[model samples]
Target: MTMNDLQELFVHKLAQQYYVERELVEALDEMARHTTNDRMSQGFADHREETRTQVQRLEEVFAALDRPAEARNSSVLEGLEEDRRELESRIEDDELLNMVYLNAGMMTERVEMTAYEGLTTLGEQLELGNDVQTPLESNYEEEKSAFRELETLATAKDLKSLWEQLTPS
Candidate 1:
């Protein structure tokens, strides 16, 4: 509560966002290894690098305020973690793997986009301008981009001959 200005809350939310994404960075690491598809594995690996930079940006945000970033777990993250575990078990089948990974990746990116947007709005409400806003906005866009990538990959699915018996419609 010590951050009197709204910009501080923006900083706080950014820090919080950092925590969630940091967790995702870890999850994505495991997810990357689980993926048999070379493209999918590489995608996760590349995103992990981006995620590291995002955490560094958050650290800069914290330093600007002379505060150390303290992480608080967002409860919703647990659900994503559990789903990913389930996903690991299901990935042996090509059909299930593609669809499940696409669906799971899309959902996780959505959660991140939602969380990042919430931070951006909170920043705007507090009269925070471009300096604080820019990085958050970039991160938001990254998640959105990931969402689109998964959708594109989803289009390759076939109903028949695929193990899942479901088409990519």
Candidate 2:
């Protein structure tokens, strides 16, 4: 536990966040593959691509700070992933899957938003300026965008129609 500078502190937090974002990229890919609804699956697929670029940006951040991009295991993301696994195992109905996917997507967005907020604050405290802040804001905006999109389709009608389209049973 070394606190050399505020910039270093942000790097530490960013490292953890970067790890989790990487993990989510893989998890979202799998979730997309499992999802029955094309739109829902596409949503996760798009985010996976987004996460890939973000990972590169995170690497740049690490380079700027002269810190190695190390991954601290993120239990927050791990727990959510476990829940996703369990939910998939239990839900056989299409309606259920749609609802569940919406919930899971929302959860991912919230977790990311929280992590980014902390990292952004740390960056500001360290006076990193727009170099770091710009990308973080982009991350924030993307998460919010994804969550709002889910909110629109989380309605009962949308879920029912999607469920019917997805579930053969």
The best candidate in terms of lDDT: 2
Model 2 Cα lDDT, one tens digit per residue, 88-167:
89988766766777788888888888988898898888888787788887887887888887777675576867657766
Each model's C-alpha lDDT?
A: 0.73, 0.81
Best by TM-score: 2
lDDT of 1 by residue, 1-169 (tens): 5888766666666666778888878877876777666777788888888888877767765665567876766777788778767776765776567556656777888888998889879877875567667877888888888888766666544422453455465
The RMSD (Cα, Å) of candidate 2 is 3.7
Off by over 4 Å in 1: 1-12, 90-95, 157-169
Q: What TM-score fits each model?
A: 0.81, 0.86
Which residue runs does candidate 2 get wrong by more than 4 Å? 2-8, 160-169
Pairs of colliding residues, candidate 1 = none
Instruction: Count clashing residue pairs in model 2.
Output: 0
